[model samples]
Target: MTEEIEAQSFEEEDVEFFEFKQFNKNALSVQLDTDTVYPEVIPPYPSLLAISNTYGYFVAATNEGFIYASTQDLHELFDNSEAGSKELLSQKIHFEISEGKVRCLRLSSDQLTLIVVVEGGLVLFYDVTKFASEKAGCQPFQIMTFPDDIRDLRPNPGEKYNLIAILLVSGIVYIKDYLLNNEISKIEGSKVGERFTAMCWSQKGKQIICGNHLGQLMQYTPEGTHKSSIQPPQELQQHYVQNVLWLESALFVVAYFPVIQEDDSELDVFIISRETKSKTLYIKSPTICSQISSDHPKLPYLYMETIKDWGPNLKCLIICASANSADINLIARDESNNWTSLNLSDTTRAALPLSEVNDEDTLPVGLALDFTCMESWITRLTADENTEVPPVPILYILNNECDIVAYRCFHKDAFFVDESFSGMSPPQKLPVTGHSSGMTLPKRDLSHSTTSTQNTTVLSAPIKTESPITDPIETGSPIVAPIKTASPVFAPIKTASPVVAPIKTASPVVAPIKTASPIIAPIKTASPMIVPTKSGISNNSLSSSISYDKNISSQKKIRTPPPDSTPSRNLGSNQPTEADSKTPHMIRMNATNNEINELHNLIEELENSYIAKYHDRTTEQCFDNPDAWLIGDLPVITSEINRLEHEASSMSQALADLRRQVNEFSHDVHIDYVKTTKDIEHLMYTPSTITVGRRGILQSRIKERLETTFKVGCYINFQRLFVYTNLYLCL
Candidate 1:
């Protein structure tokens, strides 16, 4: 993949370079720890891993039960080009259990104890520092075996003692001291038979909380005393809690349940506040993509890639799993203060040239399990102030091929950018709405109508305009329509060769309407305007009239009046004067012109209303298309129905085969029971016939030990009688 990246030709859409890259090639590799002894057979790959933010170290437990540790230089990895060139400094830690695979690995925040759990119920606790030292040797400091498999382990958040909490598969949780082999307490789960699947320590470490298979949450003190129990809401009664985390003042739980459909699944996230228990936020699976787990062989699990509070205090929860593309779901709050799930698929798609294989399969497989980010914040203010782009935390992704790629989120919206950090320049804060300004203005939807003119050839010669006369609309009243003017006659420009004829100057359009205070600028066109000069001058005056005002000459005018229309309004009144109405004999000179003015006003209102409606429909379509298609889940529903039908057929066949096997086993057990009874009956009769057992035993002993004198004398009488009888029979 790395070779392909370097050689592949990218189209315009593909991003050739990324802001993020892996700091070290050996950061997650077992090969970096050369001193560690591997098993004779092929070693198991890492099933669980974790990285320490403070110490820049990582501990990973492979399936073969080998624990590999590495001391990483985060700066070197995150900086620039030097990251991949350097090898990671590492050490290998060994333990007594060499058989079963590792199940879970967790490290304390203080880096004191490394908790290790393997398959087969074995739990090993190690001192963080000594375990990494060569002199301390390879054995765990303390070990315990549970009756059932260990599901999850969490270190006590309490600063007082170095304690760890382990959840067993048998609905029990144990809080114990890591240093001293002492069991502080054992707390039974809420239900008798249900297992505790998820557990976490309180923010202050004063309490331990665990979620059970029955969807019940229980809190316990360090000494195994029950503090409180929380039953899930009625809607979530059937769902099981898969993961629980104590993030700040909230208990975040990821719960899932199988639907009635053969393979369909649903997931819900419940965030319950510690301060106010009633304050709860429930989120269903987001509709960013289709159901990712619908066709998966295994159900979806929330694998925490990393949790960061970057860019001031923007809490970022990065989750990477098969359910959400390998890019991870960047779950964060949107601008509206609503929890929004942003998929990194689009971000990664733009940054990397992924294969054309099925994205669902290609995304989650063989990617790096551990991801970390810098402590720095890139706040909104900082982003706005910096002439250069704000330094965002780079996301490093490692694939199975060992090729690493990096990506950074693009700041495309003000709300999308982190708002935590302050700006370099002291921000001149603007007053929020409804704060300093108590006065409010109503919002109105305003639309503008643009009139386009027909294209025509340019005369190539500049025309002059006479001094413009200023006329203001009457005060205290609104003007309904623009005053009409006569059209200008075109005078041909003499040229050597005319490539194209001059364009026809269209009628002018009305100026846009303004609110409250209105200033109207007259519409001017490419052709000159002819003002009536007291004389009955030919329409030639229209071409010769030039404006003296420089502003009037420079303004590109829109023709407002319809062609061949007579002048309507007078200079001083709302209505056109009688003299302007007199026209050619064929025109209706007798009709009252007031009706014409009313009709024109009505037509203008109708045009404005049509334009407003057009804009509203366009806006509605933009928002409606996605909601109807995406939220409807049509594509996902179709695919799920097909997949479920196939799964149903397979499960039915398997169930039938299982039933047949059970019947056969039952028949064999019945035959064995009858045979045993007959043997017992025969043995009872044989016992009654064994009255000469002592005599028979004596004869057998004399024959067996005849070679020994003591033994032969002891049985001489019995042996002589047998010998005499044998001799008489022979004679």
Candidate 2:
């Protein structure tokens, strides 16, 4: 109970309950190497495995590399307009860098670089607009150092190359150039026990890819050579690859694997595709299993992107985390381009934040109802479209203790609502676009355009829908940008057109690719079955299009047809259709039958208010409220009713000392049965009184057959009945 009201407010100020302990002893005297002697602690709340934002700053980094950052303006601390600050999101220390622990932070997508890395192999980098315009702290004017530690670093998909890549821990690979401070190419691993774990870049940063642990995937060249490998997926062998992404004709990846033949481990994903070089799976999770039965089932955070105004060609999305729930799964992509996933944590529970919306001062840390890592970026300001504000999309979650929140994400393709066209009128202001189609706009303001109280602009658009796919330059097309390819270029394999068709019998291509076209779309043929991975996964009745096809180096073979030879969405209408009967498939079934008739009149007004206010209460007039108890629940119910009335007066003096030891054991068993019947009537002639000492009558016929065979074998060895009556009188 809040530690008994904080030990009764530290015993009403007599104070003596101060044991706070999180001593990193000044981060172990700023440790450099020396293996450590003792004092190190620091987990008073640590685990935040990587997060990185931009556009009015955001940086979390923890697992002990500590980091923090956020001096306001994250869209005014995620749209509440900082509500008179006191900690909507204050956090400070951009870096208390006591040597290696952080592992990864990575911001740069022109938010002007961040990086970090750590785990004893260094790397650092920072310059995030000169550490938020010199409010300084996480000092790293570029470092680097590696003797083998750093595991994954990436960067270099386009900004004309200040390059990065890295990977290390003895499986080697470098690319470096942390803006020309050296090493522009190293690579390694053509075999001799290849290790490599995961890489990205692709064919514009001039190629790279990687993956290895064992579930192979390779390919490289930013001057390091190697190239073609793949193979992966006999259900991803022993697994390992953990995240890859270059999704522009596909590489994606993910991996981790684990299911040692099923005691529940799984984490899959796959894709591959440089135009059907074929790999596919895409998203897996089924046996999630881990609510701490000795915790194991790995794999969380995935994140994807490829957007294009939530519609026509180039959709992707992805956004992961939810092995089972504090929510976060989004996924998207399907008018046959496939992908799905959903849960976007219930459209972010109507935007969440004031530290989970007014729980009355609770979060100092301790938030694992879901989301242990999430990062979605893209900030673009540019307002004055009559003072606009409706783009939404922010994200940044991270919970299992590292705390960090910041929501605003809402997606039904940017605010969808048409439950039967409610229109009681008024509600139509919709121009929302923070980087829509080729992204690149982060110079702060991040336009949440005034107005605050946070649902950051509620459903914002579809009042009666005069075509609102949420503006990628208002649909007819002017917002272009997408193809920043380093490897998702795909469309060249038409072996005679058919990669599993049936999107209402295929037809719509309409040619839409040129706003700086590097050839974007073309992968659309859906229905190869396997969709159902749960959590919402919507489609609203598939009809989407745009598949571009700029001849992506053809490598055909995608045929899969026999699911009863296709053809059906009522193959040419079996009747019905007048715009699908005035578009109201029961409008959420009459708002779920008026919420099931107000839950049957709210269960008969809560059963007549429990029969007119707590029915005939019994149990001492229903616990005769001494001010309704709970000041420590009435001192634990008056010390358990004085410990059950001193255990019923010591169980009534132990039932009078067990009835005086059962009346002295029944008066010593009736005086030892009357002194053994007067000592067997004073041993009066029992057992033929005349002792057969001389064994008369030939030992009395062997002592009467040895006393009738020792009384019929209920044998007592009185020296074996006197040696069986002297062996039956020495027969």
Query: Considering every candidate listed, which one attains the maximal TM-score?
Result: 1
Q: Write the per-residue lDDT of candidate 1 for residues 141-231, one digit (tens) a residue.
A: 4455554666677777668446888777666787766543345677775444466767778778888778877777777888988877666
Residue 547 in candidate 1 has what lDDT?
A: 23
CA lDDT scores, all candidates in order: 0.43, 0.42
Q: Write the per-residue lDDT of candidate 2 for residues 1-731, one digit (tens) a residue.
A: 11111000001111111111111111101111122111123222122333332234346555445444442333343444333332334445445566646656665445366777666455666555444344544355445555456666767766645677877756677786664344546776776657786677863677878777776667777778776765565545577666566666464535455425464444566554444444243344332212222233323334333333343332554454432223333444555655434332231231212223324221111111112213322322225332222333444444433444544333332223311111112212212221122221212111111100100111211111112121121111221212222222222112122111212332322222333213323323342222111111111001111232436322232233343455434534434345543546434434444554465577678768755543344334544676764343443466668999999999999999999987885575446434433433323434355345532543554445445445644244334445544444432
In model 1, where do residues sit more than 4 Å from their true spots? 1-47, 67-97, 135-137, 259-261, 273-281, 285-296, 305-309, 312-327, 334-337, 349-731
TM-score of each: 0.44, 0.22
Which residue pairs show backbone clashes in model 2? 203-486, 248-488, 248-489, 249-488, 249-489, 249-490, 326-369, 326-370, 522-547
Q: Which stretches of candidate 2 lie over 4 Å from their true place?
A: 1-56, 59-88, 91-108, 112-157, 160-199, 202-204, 208-214, 220-227, 230-240, 243-256, 259-399, 404-731
Best by lDDT: 1
Worst 10 residues of 2 by lDDT: 3-12
